[model samples]
Target: MSREHWEPVTVFTGGLKPLPPEGQMTGMYKVRRDTPVFCDIEGLRGDAQGDRRVHGGPDKAVHLYPADHYTRLAELMPMASNLLLPGVLGENLSVSGLVESDVCIGDVFALGDARLQVSQPRRPCWKISHRLGVDAASRLVADNGLTGWYFRVLHPGDIPPDGALELVERPSPGMTLARLWALEQSHRPSVEEVNTLAEAIGLATQWAQRLKNRADWLARNV
Candidate 1:
């Protein structure tokens, strides 16, 4: 298997106080994914936002920092147990050893008892600088694209520390994490334009469906 498709070895969670019940970690073990538990979709809360870090609800979300700067994030939190970068996302689960190319929108993460599907890549904002140190968040966004996502929980429950991690289902074509990132940036395209590009990229059917869903979402937001 490609390194991209490898199983997630380290799951981490981030906070001002990043360590958990005990110090059971390594470079392979970092925040969010590294932590014993994770949560999302509840609401935003953290030291950066001034709230204790906890798991579950819509407030919980996941974000990923990449391995390219292992030496740096490691140093920043040399005594920290893990590094939690800000504004990257409401990152409930911070993952390691996984690549963005390996995921897609609507792809489900099967933790056996439950699952989470990729929604979209995080959009950068000021909160990042607040959580991660001013310039650090900017750098993460520019360098790694933060390369993480929001996983809507299909089944909310305990994600056992000792268990299997599997990819239950791959999203349809054109919905890969990379493709969704590309499509999200395509705000100027017309329906015809999107269809043409979607077809050429084999995203026609999925893109059309996604577009409808996106339209509904945007309409409600407006």
Candidate 2:
């Protein structure tokens, strides 16, 4: 029998609080995407907002993820759920099974009532390690890439507490954890190298350039 590989368990959200509050955040959270919230594309479409709040909406940006991200990371430690806390993200939206990091800029998934379009990987900050713990928090952003991707709301609505997630399409077709890691082999990737590699995977031209730029910077500095 085919085992159930991935399943979104829950979607947690911080009602309305400080985005990334400085401290252990508890309570005042909502079960954002449990077995219900369906994701869909709406509002902005086919654009790279990076770390800007252009994906979800002008007021509230949403971080959607599959549950496996937590189960796996939580496997590392219990308190890691501290990151899962709601107001910690001012509002979080968790899911089960799929690696949130694996979702790249442009990938699409159907939540419950709507769909979500991936914008970019979440760049790790010190706070993450603080929430998830030192080692895991540090490695999560760098290696796992399970950083829950952002989505632009094409449909205006809320993901009810009984929706299922569906994989519509991947934004970066060829961009996977393994492929993206290949860019770091030399510790410095050239523009041509970055462009060719990223384009090979169906990455948007501009987004490819952005990644290439990151590699170039890494190469020059590190």
TM for every model, in the order presented, reads 0.54, 0.58
The most accurate candidate by TM-score is 2
Stretches of model 1 off by over 4 angstroms after superposition: 1-9, 12-90, 139-144, 162-164, 186-222
Give the range of the ten consecutive residues with the poorest summed lDDT in model 1.
43-52
Show how many residue pairs clash in every candidate, following the order shown.
29, 40
The TM-score of candidate 1 is 0.54
lDDT, candidate 2, 47-140, per-residue tens: 1222333233422245554455555566565665556543233234555555643454455555555655554444445545654445566565
lDDT of each: 0.45, 0.48
Give the candidate number with the greatest lDDT: 2
Clashes of 2: 40
